[model samples]
Target chain A: MNPLAEIVAITAVCVLSGCLGSLLGLGGGTFVVPILTLAFGLDMRLAIGASVISVVAGSAAASPRYLDEGFANLRVAVALEVATVSGAIAGALLAGHLSTRALYTVFGVVLAVSAVQMLRHRQDRDGLAVPDDPIADALSLHGTGTGTTVRDIRPYRVTRTATGLTMMTAAGAISGLLGIGSGAMKVPAMDLAMRLPIKVSTATSNLMIGVTGAASAVVYLQRGDVVPLLAGAVALGTVVGARIGSRLLAVVPAGALRVIFLVVLLIVSVQMLLRGLA
Target chain B: MKAAPGAPEAGARQVALVLRIGGGLGAALVLAGLAVSFAESGGGWLHGSGVDPLGGDATMRLSDLIGGLRHGRAGAIVLLGAIVLAATPAAGVVTAGYTWLRARRAWLAGVAVVVLLLLVLAATLGATE
Candidate 1:
């Protein structure tokens, strides 16, 4: 392929993926890897490498905007990081010992379960009365959503802290073992388990995904999986797309976001199941 | 229990500042590297010359980046940009930790430290792989 064409093509794909990634808190790898491999005919390793860079780029670029908008919960992010990072470390340690196919199968089932749960609670809004967990109380994870265009202010409380943390651990472990960001897992955990606002869940997941990606990106870099020109094109494109997506989040209704997330979740679940079976 | 007035806002601002700086620098470097590659290829880089003009060598270590920079390798410059981009979130985490400490939230600050340590561990594990 012509160097220029390659750069242009990859950038275009990244722009679309980055937009969706930031909008949905997915980090874009779920889309980028498959598109590069199946559509563009790129090497899988190369695609994963580029996906990692793109995920970091999209997450990092959009995060500041989310923070400014008060959609991202920093307290929740920090509290959950303890669980996700520990899961990631454990998964990394057990990476070689476990079977990828089996992990995929299990993760697919988990996603399916999460999708069902999300659907069942689609109408549930934040600021609802719920029993509080001791950990959430201690960490002060509850907050009032400010700086959002959707409402003047919506105060929300955290619940089922232990469940959310457990889900985060599993999410992190999946990412560590599969070398994916697994934002799909993070958003659902926050929204369904911790009972955070959907926007807050998405935005905070956006921020957290970048932090998790930073760790494995080094491995990809050292292993020579990252092609500089290719990954650079991806990084550049995702940043631009993420900026656009972040602005869109202020207007995109939470109900609509939930629908989009469900579609993405189902698609990802089926894809993982197929891969595992294959 | 409630936090100090505007504590979350203050923390968010600090984290945002770090992210903007890191993300901006990374994007600029990537753009610059692309420009250099275009210049080296004399506009044929994007137009499809028979030879690949922008192929970058895979760098194995940080030291390799310095060496590549001395040679003005476009790929290395881009790789460095990507690495910086990847590192931005971790930097944000560190900044958040500092913010937590300033708020006198020892537990949250300690959580930040543990997160950082885990990140380093994950990186080290990857490096060994």
Candidate 2:
């Protein structure tokens, strides 16, 4: 492809994927990697390296703003990082030696499962109403109402610490292995297993994915899995795409956004499977 | 927690808008630079046998892609640097945009940025080989 054409293509993909991901609460990596590898014919390792860079860039960019708005719980995020970072390191090391076929198969399966889960629970938007454990009270993982009187002062507590941590470990491992941000898995786990509010779960997961990506990125760098030129390109595209998507968030309806997300996931899963088989 | 009644909504909107435009432009510049350089290099030079900074085959090693930019055509090096600088902020712009559009979930935006970066890296690096 011509330089201009390639640039436009990548930019379009990134922007669309970012929008869908944000709407559905998924990491763009799940969609981005498959397109690059299957549609664009790039190698899996190279795609993974680029994806990792983009994940860090996106996380860092969005984090401060969220923190400033009190949407992100720094205390909870920092506490979780201890587990995520370590898991990422192990996952990255494993990624270096894993067969591309295996990686794709696993990634495809995960995407399919995640898609089903999203579809099944599409109507459940209510946040946790009651604290299920002492840790949640101590941590103050509660939600305060901004305008509404009926749902004012909703407190979100971590009911299942052990389960949440275990899920995080799995999320971190997937992140390192496939070079995906894995927020899809992490957010849901936190929400369902630990009973965190959707907003808090999303913010906390975002805070932690960067740390996880950083840990694995180092491993990829050492293993010679990361390509600077390619990484640079992906990082650039993701940043631009993410910026566009973030801006459009308010104008889009929640239902429409969710549909877009499901479509993207379906397409990505097929692409990953095809790439792995090829 | 409820915001104190009478918080500055206008100010917050202004800040968000500013962040969006600034971050978008930065990311675009980086992608443009990488696309230009990768095209100019014809994607063949990345695979040509050459000694990289790591003292290994430049084609197979990721380090070579990073460490070997200086050794490439001078124009390519400049483009590479521009791409890296621009791409970082682009990530922020993309994330913010996503947050505005969908769940307003900050992490999803972060994930978007990271994934885009990885795609760029893979394309540019893999093309070299």
Candidate 3:
């Protein structure tokens, strides 16, 4: 692909990815990474660097609405960052020693797992039950459970706090290692492990991803994996796409979209795994 | 119980505000760089070898990038834009930390500071390499 054509192509695909990712409450990095490595023929390392830029771009763009609308929990976000940020740095350091093929293999596994999780789509109406965790109480992590879009805000007690942190650490490491936003891991850690409401977990994951991506982004930048023109185009496309996607989410019936996205992810995951093997 | 406006929610709003301004500025600069690049290169964007994202030859020091901008190099400007975009979230994190402080949440403030330090450390590490 012509270098400029590559930028233009990635930008176009990223716009669609950003739009759909935001609409589904999945950060855009998943789509961004595959497109760069597969379509643009960028090395896995360079692709990760560019993908993180788009993830941060989309987060910065859509976060205002998610936060202001009461979908995200700030206390939880801050609490989790201590684990995620540290893990991201660790993952980044490890990336230096790991070979290109090793990174690709890991990326394939992550994509496959994320695809299955997305298809599952946790039941929405599970009653909120707040657990008795002293750490959560000390940190004031127990949220008031006032929702903006989901209207039925139930303040739930946290459970398995330590496990949640452990999962978050892994998520952060995967994020830094793969150059993804790590929402796939973070969301489950918060939603299933910690028992946060799905809405809060998803939105908070969006907020956390930007910070996680930014942290490891410095590592990529230092290593010169970030191509400015390519990254800039991806960033531009993502921000624009996220803006449009967020607006559409209000009206769209997400059930159908979720099904469509599941099939797409499965195919992409398989392709990535094969590429890694090859 | 009907929910009242909370301090954390308010702090999040402020952080969101910072992100909007910082990200918008960064995106605008990048787009501007693209326009300039198109004009200077005269439709050669598609003809050059694919982007060398991890190549040493493509990497330049921050100082050199600034100097390149003076010479009207679009790539330099684009790089500046990227650097700004990368930092914008850290700025927001600091802002959030400050907000947590004002709200008298010391632990959250501490968390913010720690994350801020990590970001600085990461960037410093990048510069060294």
TM-score of each: 0.85, 0.70, 0.90
Off by over 4 Å in 3: A1-4, A121-128, A144-149, B1-8, B46-64
Give the distance in Å from residue A24's predicted Cα in candidate 2 to where it truly belongs.
3.7
TM-score of chain B of 3: 0.81
| Model 2 alpha-carbon drift over 4 Å, by segment | A122-132, A137-154, A274-278, B1-129
lDDT of 2: 0.56
How do the residues A118-153 of candidate 1 rate in per-residue lDDT, one tens digit apiece? 688555353457985898888778886642345546
RMSD (Cα, Å) of model 2: 9.1
- Model 1 residue B51 CA deviation (Å) reads 7.0
Per residue, candidate 2 scores C-alpha lDDT tens digits across A35-83 of 7777767677777876776676555445444444444454455445545
> Which candidate has the highest TM-score of all?
3
Q: Write the per-residue lDDT of candidate 1 for residues B15-101, one digit (tens) a residue.
A: 998999999999888889877876777467556765553243433344467877989988788888988998898899999999889
Predicted chain A of model 1: TM-score relative to the true chain A? 0.83
Error of 2 at A56 (Å): 1.1
Error of 2 at A34 (Å): 0.5
Off by over 4 Å in 1: A89-121, A125-129, A146-149, A254-278, B1-8, B42-63
Worst 10 residues of 1 chain A by lDDT: A145-154
Scored against the true structure, residue B22 in model 2 reaches a CA lDDT of 43
DockQ of the two-chain complex in candidate 3: 0.45
